[model samples]
Target chain A: MLTAILSGDTPRSRILTVLLLAVLVCLAAAPFLFPGVRALETAATICIFIVLVASYDLLLGYTGIVSFAHTMFFGLGAYGVALASTHLGRSWGALLVGTASGAVAAAVLALLIGLFSLRVRAIFFAMITLAVASAVAVLVSQLFEITGGEDGLTYQIPRALTPAFRFGELFGVNLNGRIINYYLVFAASLVLFLLLLRIVNSPFGRVLQAIRENDFRAEAIGYRVVWYRTAATCLSAAVAALAGSLYAIWLRYVGPDTTLSFEIMLDILLMVVIGGMGTMYGAVLGAVIFVLAQNYLQSLMGVAAGAAEGLPVLPLLLDPNRWLMWLGILFILSVYFFPTGIVGRLRSGR
Target chain B: MSPGGANSPRPRPQGGVRLAARPDAGAAGHDPPTEAALTTTLLATDGLTVRFGGHVAVDAVTCAFRAGELTAIVGPNGAGKTTYFNLISGQIAASAGRVSLMGEDITRLSVAERCRRGLGRAFQLTNLFPDLTVLENVRLVIQARERKGFGLLSTAASHSGITTAAEAVLDRVRLADRAGSKVSELSHGNQRKLEVAMLIALDPRVYMFDEPTAGMSVDEAPVVLDLIAELKHDSDRTILLVEHKMDVIRTLADRIIVLHNGALAADGPPAEVMASDVVQEAYMGKALEDV
Candidate 1:
């Protein structure tokens, strides 16, 4: 059954399988297991980022396309939800309309970009995507009336999905709509992640990998390289948009800093590389490790700094404010040691 | 056997620039065969030309390949032999002309579209997916040929039919044992063998091999040649080979088309073309007495 769910693309290594299971279980029971408001927020962020990073993998790892417009798609979805919920009066139907429109808009934009730019060299494509993405970002910040500009939008979700509506207690934990919302994000993320797994293990996925390895040969082998690439771009954009919708729903707010920030884009890239490029399971590991480090690494650093107080330079270096530096060093070490990312290293049994 | 009759008009260089200024250059061995065989031309180029800046790499060189015959295209370095193959296979667009396959003009078609219309091309350089296993390299071609390349939900592993077909091709190429190994890890000879195996899996009506055995060991060369010979037995498949070795061509090609300075220097039976003075002078760079 597990094999069928994974599309028979097994994790390969025992350690990797265990790690994946642990991540799955932890995310599945994040509210009960972690049991803190901040912990739950971090868990939700990890879930959304997993979907985002995996969608990027579909482009970068599977199709060998480097796209910087992923966060733009993510922002589109958030804006879609924010606008619909505000104008149409915070209903499930409004959320549905927003999510659908966001995904469709993202797909259309991706198609246009792909048709215009995919025929060029890889570096040119990358540059075009970067240019398009930054333009979209500037447009969002300039459009104050509709997109809420830099301030962004704060809107209400359905009453059943908020913390105010309490049902009962279960296993000494409060049974409120907040936990229900967490499960909603978790369920959607799991389904989307599994669908992505199915995609990568399908014949279409194999063709994408073939293109990644050698686009010229893929073209000669009777596969329309441009067509396949465009299709992948559209699909990846739609999925990223969907992840954005879930993120908006979970946070009950949407903003440029939260969704459209270039920092988040770089974070997604780091997660994908840290996890592994081609392996779908890498997204899970990459998002979990990166998010945990982003959220808790500072506290961990503070604890280390306190312990190393007597040491001369060690405490200053281990200071919580230097967490970004520590993160950079971790990234370098991971790249230097694992090379293929954590999942790749584990699967190779090295 | 040569298909067209002596009365059939020959291909003339379109532009004013005469590449090989011999009057009898394109008119070799136009004798009508005694027995009229109803041969269908599978692939044909009409005034196919490509120019780089001012230099015409492939001059207005027109040629037709019919079913069941293996035609070897031989030329010296930079004779536009591979460039012609590229033009026909849709790798390089022609500066002026049309390419037709099975009676349909495919000049404007993309490489994949041409391949879908029964045009298969194997490169001189090994072009297998380096990251994928040997079986996977062949399997992708089979998947693309079977039109399952776009299947999203159906797992590739669920299709036992594709796996079986891919394994069969690998078995034919004698790389079945190395199927589990990555293409990058394979020996150079095995990589070449896998290239042929992928073409076989494609199973196009027209097979274009650009130096199929250019860098193979002696023992490895025979396997690919024998495979090509087997493919030639199929009367519906037309084979075009670009080779430099004289011995390989002598043993395999039914007809030889010699290209010099990107023009048709000689086109006829291998024996006739090999013995021609033009071929002797231009290709060999020496007279019969010089050797």
Candidate 2:
């Protein structure tokens, strides 16, 4: 069953398998294990980001396509959910409608961008995506009446998925709609991740990898390079948008700062790289580690600073406010040590 | 056979019925009238040309390659041999011209479309998926040929037929043992052989080879040459080879088309083209002097 789920492309390393299992277990039991609102929120974010980063990997790692407009797709999903819920009222049907429309819209936009830019050089495609992404960001911010502008949209979901709806108590913990919602996100993310795994191990995925390796040779061998690339871009965009819908559902809010910010795009890139490029398991690890660090690293640094209060420069260096600097240093060290990202390093037995 | 204009009209036989009448027409120049009557043109270029800015790379060149023949395109450096191949293969768009396959115009087709239309090209430089294993490199070609490359959610391993076919191709090329090894790890000669293996897997009606034996050791060259020779046995497949070595051309090519400075300099059998004064002055002057 595991082989079928993974499409027979296993982690191929003992450590990677263990690490992946640990992530899966932690995510599966995030509510009971973490036992805090903050931890639950972080867990949900990790779940959504895992899907987002993995979709990006389908483009960047597997297809050798670099796209900066991923956050735009994510934002589109969030907006889709937000706008539908805002206008259509708080219902499951509204959420479904929003998610589907968002995905379709993102796919259409991606197809247009891909057809126009993918025929050019890779660098040109990158530049065009960057430009298109920033343009969409600006447009979203400018469309005040419909998009809620910079303030964004804070809309309600179905009452069953809200924190107010409580069924009972389990293990002295309140079994509320919030926990149910977390599981909903978890299930969707898992299914999406597994589907992505199946895709990367499919014949289509092999052709994408062949294109990544050598587009010229792939074309010569009778694969339509442009069509395959455009298809990949569309698929990646739709998945990213789906992740965005889940994010909006979790937060009960959708804003440019939360979903569409360039920072989120950069974070997705970092996660994909830090975990591993081509391996789907890398997305799980990358999202978990990066999200955990983003959430808890500051507190960890504060504790270290407290412990080193007597030390002069050590305390200053370990200050909680300098967490960004510490993250930068950690990124540099990881890149130096785990050049192929953490999953690649583990799988290679390095 | 006449050695002049490649575009000259010939009394083409209607179909398979006339070919059986003259079974001994295999030897070129033996029976010119019978050979012309029996030949079927598989690929033709009509005033095919390409220009790079101010330079006409492949000038107005018209050539027709018949089925059951291996034509070697020889030329001096920068004589547009590779450029002409590129134009036909749809790698480089022709500034103006028409390329036809099996009597159907395919000048505006994409590279993949052209390949799907039975135009298989092997690059002068080793163009391959270096990261993939040798078996995988050929498997992709076979998968593409089978139109199974678009199978999403269907695991590649599920297609046992593709693997079996790929293995058969590797066995033919003698790279069966190296099937699991990456293409990058293969020796240069083995890589070239893998290139031919991929082309064979493509199973195109027209085989376009651009220096298939370039940059190989003495022993490695013949493995590919032998494969090309083996491919020549198929009368249905039309083969066009761009080569620099005179001896290799003399041994393999049934007809020779010489290009000098982006123009057709001579077109004939190997002996006649080799002894032609125009070819000698344009391409083989230095080589003949060395001899």
Candidate 3:
């Protein structure tokens, strides 16, 4: 509000301001430090993940509704765009239509899911979302007639910016030229991120948080609790769908595996939980950590596997995939060290 | 007994629970005293009834919450005090009668609809956004009010007007010092006060406060009561307070209404209502039994 913008240092806002600044600066510095544009691209992808985490925070953080099927919304956007553009013989116009349909699909799913679960307790809702996610994964995999099953779908997308990298001259673009996609995704993520930030700070956002903390009390004061939750879900779903669409565009491919994966759901849940539920910037923090860990773990696996095959000494090296053994350890540590996740850290003025 | 740290005060009065309304500095330029004063019928429930599956919680009770005055509904435990509040607030469906607000049929109105029509409420329980600052909670309601009045988003300068309005309400509630404090950080007493502040802060035409003083000490009780009186005496907004403390009711309310067994036991001036035979039997039996 006006007071928030005008006045200095209300406890939560102060923390938020600092965290936001740190996230932006770190992201800006990514390319310079990594010595390649690819590094910056990776950072942008992380920013997209932040969008996902932030949307989940709206549902899980502010509204206190943990949705296991939110990834389905994301996957819907990803695969929906692929099928629409490639099969329907379309272009950027199709991309626009695909985004709208993706959001609509998410809203419809939320409505049907919310109809039964909103009245039920929180844990029950979580269980139902989990059920939907699990079922959707199976359904997408079996529907070869529509989805092309495991083969997935990939189609060329027209890009005005592509020619800039076509010569492999500007910043030495090559087959590994994911840098442009990173910038594009980053720009989209930033726009959505800022909009979501305003929303959480808006009156509507406060009401959603109030509902999160306690619904019975909110209802007594004439807040239509159900409506607020449903609306929040819709907005959050649309954001997730956006991220999914961007993900497909970045990879230039989409498949049943992309839309149906529980891994994506777990990753999103982990991102928000690690970052902080109620805070928007926490999502960004969570995303950075998640993406970094994934890369680091994958690299470690590649090193260990390659080194194990031919090491000068101590040839007792194991496969890098063994790093999976440490994933549980890392998750436990993050949850333990930061009970409130990253949001709690920011709240403490970190 | 008050489950909260808000210790029981006056054994919970019987009948109507009224809350104070927001004060306007006469921006309307229409003098309430010179006018017919809204006919004291902002809300009316006709043969309104509610039943909880097997039991009739509120039975065929016809009552009206009027404009321009504070009317307190006080009753003992299980007297359908909350059931009645729920009926009016549209938290639950009315089994039978019609509820009309501002002469418009509002019986089937959703809670949000009632809010849109300048109706705000304070709960017997704290309904604050605990993580939000005291100022922010009021501001959200202000925004909610503005959205209802001016289609979601007005201009920036007009939005600043809402901030000013929120600031004034905080000052009125004596919570200006704690504007930056989260609801969770506030004491139990302050939370009760904040609940009272929120009820009046939105500048609603009608307010229903259920047991506004359930947790306050006798000293704190008077502060809330005086605020109620101040809000009602403004002559613009109407208030309905449910209180167990007769002293608060006697100090603040223009008229006192008593509900017993989900029916009107007494409705009149404080002294007259206090002397009713049914009210005496249902309410004062223990407090003044020996006398």
Candidate 4:
């Protein structure tokens, strides 16, 4: 199973495989072990973000393109599903419609950006995507009537996935809407993750890696660089949309802050870089580590803050109020030491 | 397996000043100068020109590469040999004039489009997918030939036909033993061989080799030159070799073209062009003996 997911037979790979399996088993059994809504919600968000970051890796790691517009697609998916559920109908059919519309819209947008902006050099292309993403985020916020302005939209999900539908008891635990929703998210995320694995292992995936390594050489060998880049962008955007739709459904809300924030984009970049660029396992590792830190770090900072105030001179060194500073310092240290990200360093066994 | 396989008409000299005259190689058991085969043009540039602001890089260079022959373009530094090759290969758009491949106009095609139409090019500088294995590099060339770039459902590793073909190409270049090694790990000469191997896998109709043996050590230069010679005879492909080594030119080139200050200085059979006074003054500097 380890060999199926990862390349090579090194000891590092074996260790990572075992670690990944442990994480998977733990996630699967989380609700039962913890038996609470908060734990279940945390586990579910981790799952959604796993899909999101993995899709982002398709561009950043595999295709060697740095796109800052990932969250735009994510927000598009959430908005699509949320709008469909409210206006069309709060049914499974509406969910399907929402997912399809969101993916298609994101694909078209990606294609257009790839066509027009990709002519620039790499760093410049990144700037163009950043500009376009920022502009769109503002557009989403300004459309107050339809997009609910800055507050965002809230709507019903399919009844089957809601608290109104109790699907009996399982293993002495009541299988209510909450438990069903968690399982649904878990199953969907797993399927998408595996599908992404299949894609990255295919010939098309090899071409993407080749492009990443040297697009000029790829073109010299007769591979149309633009078409391949555009295809990768579209595919990444489509998958991100799927993740966004799932997040909206899981939360029962879609807002500018929740769905389309630049902060979320920054978080994704940190996740991918911290996990490892190019390596699929890095996406998973990065998402799990970063999301967990995000959820608990503030509280940990609060505790440290109280303790630091009592200290003689350690107050400035580890300020409890500046969580971002601490995170940034850790990030710099990781980058300085690992250089290739945590997964890359671990796989290299250095 | 000469080019055209007894079907092509010989190339006719377009209206241009003849720099040197010499005996054609027809009497030496080569193909007789049927007006048809002698005039069969595989690639031709008509008044091709390029300029960077006010500095013209390639100035009105009109020449024809015959279907089965090897032509050497030689000149001193800053002579526009590489730029001319770039224009013909569509690396950069020509400022003016047209480039044609086998009678079809290709002046406006992109590099990849030109490649799809059987134009193979190797850069003066070694360019390769350095992160890919040597076999993987060749495999990508073959994969491009097979139009498998969009084969999302099929695994690139499991494609037996492509792998076998790629291995065969590696064997031809004698890099089969290092097939699994990364391109970056290979020596410079080996990288040159792998670049040639990639072009061979492309199976293009015309090959444009730009300074193929440029940076090789003395011991490795002859091996690459021999491989290139073998390629010319083995495939019967039209070859445009950009070389500065006069000995290499004398050994392999059927015809020689000398470029001076972005203009054609001399064009004819090797021995006759070697004897031209204009070539001596503009390119060879001291004399033919000094080089």
RMSD in order of candidates:
4.9, 5.9, 8.1, 6.4
Instruction: Please rank every candidate by TM-score, starting with the best.
Output: 1, 2, 4, 3
Off by over 4 Å in 1: B1-39, B286-291
Two-chain DockQ for model 1: 0.80
Number of backbone clashes in candidate 1: 0
Per-residue accuracy of model 2 over A1-350 as CA lDDT, tens digit each: 88887898988999888888888899899899888899999999999999999999999999999999999999999999999999999999999999999999999999999999999999999999999999999999999999989999999999889899999987778899999999999999999999999898899999999999999989988899999999999999999999999999999898889988999989999999999999888899889888999999999999999999998899999999999998888888888899999988997786
Model 1: per-residue lDDT, tens digit, A67-145?
A: 9999999998888888889999879999999999999999999999999999999999989999999999988889999
lDDT of 3 by residue, B195-268 (tens): 88888776788888888888787766666777777777666567878777766677777787655555444566
Residue pairs clashing, model 1? none
CA error at residue B2 for candidate 2, angstroms: 25
The DockQ of each candidate is 0.80, 0.73, 0.18, 0.50
Residue A209's lDDT within candidate 2 is 96
Which runs of model 3 end up more than 4 angstroms from their true locations?
A1-41, A88-97, A107-121, A159-165, A168-177, A220-222, A301-319, B1-39, B148-158, B234-237, B288-291
- Native-to-model Cα distance after best TM-score fit, residue A141 in candidate 1, in Å: 1.5
How high is the lDDT of residue A156 in model 1? 91
User: For candidate 2, lDDT tens digit of each residue in B1-291?
Assistant: 121224522212222111111112332312233346335778888767777877767766677888889999987788799999999999999888799998789999999999998999999988999988998899899999999988997899889999999999999888999999989999989998988889989999999999998888898788889989999999898999999888888899988876655655556676666765545654666654432
C-alpha lDDT (0 to 100) for residue B127 of candidate 4: 91
Q: What lDDT tens digits, residue by residue, belong to model 4 across residues A230-337?
A: 999999999999999999889989999998999999999998999888887787888888887777676787877678897886766656567778788878888899
lDDT of 4: 0.82
**Candidate 2 wrong stretches, greater than 4 Å:** B1-39, B286-291
lDDT of 3 by residue, A166-284 (tens): 43433433432355556677788888877776666656776787688768656545577887888888888888888888887777788866655888788888888888778776788
